[model samples]
Target: MNDMLQVARREIKTGFRNPWAYSFLILFCVFSLCLLVINSQSIVQGYSGVTGSMLSLILYLLPLMTLFLGSFSLTAEKEEGSWQLLSTYPIGSLSFIVGKYIGLSIVLLTIVAFGYGLMGVISGLVGMSFDSTTYVLFIAFSCGLVLLFLTLALLIGSLSKNRWQALTVSVSIWFFAVIGWQTILISVLNFLPYTWIKPTLVALTFINPAELVRLFVVIKLGGGSILGPEYYQWVDWIQRSSGSWLFIAVCMLWISFSIMVVYWLWERGRSHG
Candidate 1:
């Protein structure tokens, strides 16, 4: 546990030292702020009332940044031969992975929280109101999504041999996860026979976490009064739909399988050598 904490601290310190990470965070925050300003008018018109939309935006989009950071995490160390040094230490792989995850999540969460504040400013400008409970739920949802994305990114990082390969895989995964499903859904609708459309959509969406998050959020925002009795429904929907438990279950399955695959590949590479 102590070792993991130390490793996590090292990862966090290294991340802070990296110029690209800081630059990316700044740029993302700036762009999100711009979007909030533009949407402020919509809020006044009652079209943009989701209290957590800004934070949610940051949570969804931060996957790209998280991917880049995480993919580079181990691959860069490996390329520099630093991973060899760590391996020689009294460090466990699980400690290394979990530590890096914690450290990086802290950094990402800070950036998203800042975005949430920027969002609150937009809400105020638009004259929309949200009580304390809604604010908590929004933050909780954002945290869960951020962890889910970063975990996948870390797994990709562990698998790649070099920074470039890691980056390619991470970005490709992000592209497919974020946009590929939508494209597939559209194609299924337009090209497939009518009978197959709904089934295709259901299968694609049911398995796709991104779509689930969006679906859950849209329904929550549109289906209730922000400050009224129906607020519990929105809260309940978010809690269930945040998919934290499901995501953790999926990640555990993914990691267990991934570790087996990586070990097999490692053994094969050694045998070949």
Candidate 2:
């Protein structure tokens, strides 16, 4: 436990010192403030077009930012031989990875919070009305994006042999997960039987954290109807009293499963070579 905390503290220090961290920080802050432009439009109740667009904007940016930041940090350790040095210590792989996760989560979440906070403050100064509930939910959505996607980033980092490899895989994943998921899902589902589509879609939704979190947040915002009529039944079930809890359960499962895989892979690499 002490070793894990030490690793965590070390990650925190290095994460902030990394220049890529600050570059992402600046980009997110600039993009976040652009929400004011969308706010200029009239607000409709319940996940207004304005808010929905904002959600999409955030979905596009945060996951990639997280993937790059997390992946590069891991890959750099390997490339610089720091990971080899760390392995020489008494600490285990689980402790090191979990510690990195803990520290990176803090660093990324802080950037997320600061970006939104700056946006809120600027909007206030400009006399724009951003709803408190909506503000809170969007922040939650962004934080969820950061936390969930960071796991994926760590996994990519673990798999990559170098920063270049990590960067390539990260972009590929961000493209497929965030940008191309819907089209690919539709095309692939067509090959399945009619009876299989619904369940398959549900299963696939859980496979990608980006889709899962976005869908849950949309439902929580009472905008599930915008997902189109095909999702009506599933969305209805999720809107039930315990639906959010169910979503939370899936998220917990995803984190556990992914972390286990990452740790398993890392420990395997350590053993093999």
Candidate 3:
């Protein structure tokens, strides 16, 4: 535990030294503030309207930022031969990866907290009523989405032989998760039997952390108003299945699955080398 914490501290320090981290944070803050200011009229609906809009923004941006950060962090170490040097020390591979994840998660969470907190403060100042419970859930779920993508990014980094490869793959994944997946799903839904569409959509939501996060937030903010009536049934089904906890569990599953894949790939490469 102590060693893991030390590794986490090292990663945190390294992240702080990087200009990209600061840039990402600044961009997030600026965008969040702008969003709040622009949607000032909608703030009368409480946090739900604002949070829904922010969820859309987060769905698009957070995955890309996390993917780039996590991929580069690992690939840079490998390129500089630092990972090899570190292996000579007492740290195990699991500890190193977990620590890095922990450190990155902390950084990401801090960014989310500050950005949302600022939004809350601004909304309050503008006389927007507070929905503290809903606001807190939105922040928590957004952080969970970040952790999911971070794990995925590390897996991509571990699989790639170099930084360029990792970057390319990571961007591809971001594109798919953010844009391509939805396009494909929509096209497929048009052709699927009416009976199959709902179940398929539900399954797809579980498979994609981005979609799942959006759904989770939508449900928490009180059902399918944001997504229209087409999705209300899906939301109802999730509610029946006790979906809030289920969604959280599935997100944790994504993190675990990605980490397991990274460990396997890392071990295989080490053995071969």
Candidate 4:
């Protein structure tokens, strides 16, 4: 535990010292602030309008930020032979991985909070009304999504031989999750029988963290009115079956599974070489 904290602290310090970290911070703040300012004037439905807009934006940006941040975190160290030096020490690989994950998660969470909190402050100054419960839920969902992507990034980093390889994989994943996932799902649906479409879509949603987060946020915010009638039925079924809890469980499983893969790969490589 103590070793993990030390590793986490070092990772946190390294992240804050990096120039790109600040760039990410600035990008998130600027985008979030701009969105808040633009919507402040037309916030008709209290927090729903703003929250919905912010969720859409986050669904696009957060994955990109996390993928790059996570992909670079360990790969750069490996390229510099830092891990070799650390291996000479008493720290176990599991501790190192867990520590790095915790540290990066804290850094990402801080950036996310700053971006969202800045918007909240700006919205308050402009007298935009928002429901506290909905606002909190949005923040929670966003944070959970960030952590999810960070774990994935770390897994990719652990499996890659160099920073460039890690980065390439990271960007490809971001593209698939943020942009290509829906198109792929649509194509798959076109080939499936009508009876299997809904269940398949629901199963697909569980497979993609992005979709899981979107479903949770939409259901919690009561934004189903904007969805098509077929989706509404799907959402209703999900809600009735406590799908939100299941989603949360799946996210937890993803994180654990990712960490285990990282550990297994790292150990295998070390044993073979």
Candidate number achieving the greatest TM-score relative to the actual structure: 2
lDDT of each: 0.64, 0.88, 0.79, 0.82
User: Residue 236 deviation, candidate 2, in Å?
Assistant: 2.7
TM-score of 1: 0.70
* lDDT per residue as tens, model 4, 1-273: 999999999999999998878999999999877766656666434336666777778888888899889889989878999988888888888898999999999899999899889989888887876557766776877797888888888888888889889879988988888789979998999999999988998788766788778877787677777766658765675566687677678788988988888888777776675
Cα lDDT, model 2, residue 9: 94
User: What residue pairs are clashing in model 4?
Assistant: none
Q: Pick the candidate with the highest lDDT.
A: 2
C-alpha lDDT of candidate 1 relative to the true structure: 0.64
Q: What is model 1's C-alpha RMSD?
A: 6.1
- Candidate 3: residue 246 lDDT (0-100): 74
Clashing pairs in 3: none
Compose the digit string of candidate 1's lDDT tens values, residues 1-273: 998899889988998888867787787678656655655454322215444455445544666777888778867876898767877788766676667778888877877687678767777776755454445555555655666667666667666888889888977877777757667666667987867765666566545555545445444444334433423543454557554466457545644554454445434533453
After TM-score superposition, what is the CA distance of residue 203 in candidate 4 from its true location, in Å? 3.2
TM per candidate comes to 0.70, 0.95, 0.87, 0.89
Give the lowest summed-lDDT range of ten residues in model 1: 42-51
Q: Which ten residues in a row have the lowest lDDT in candidate 2?
A: 40-49
**What digit string (tens of lDDT, one per residue) describes model 3 on residues 62-125?**
8888988898888988899988988888877788888889998888777778888888888878
Between prediction 3 and prediction 4, which has the larger TM-score? Answer: 4
lDDT of 4 at 135: 66
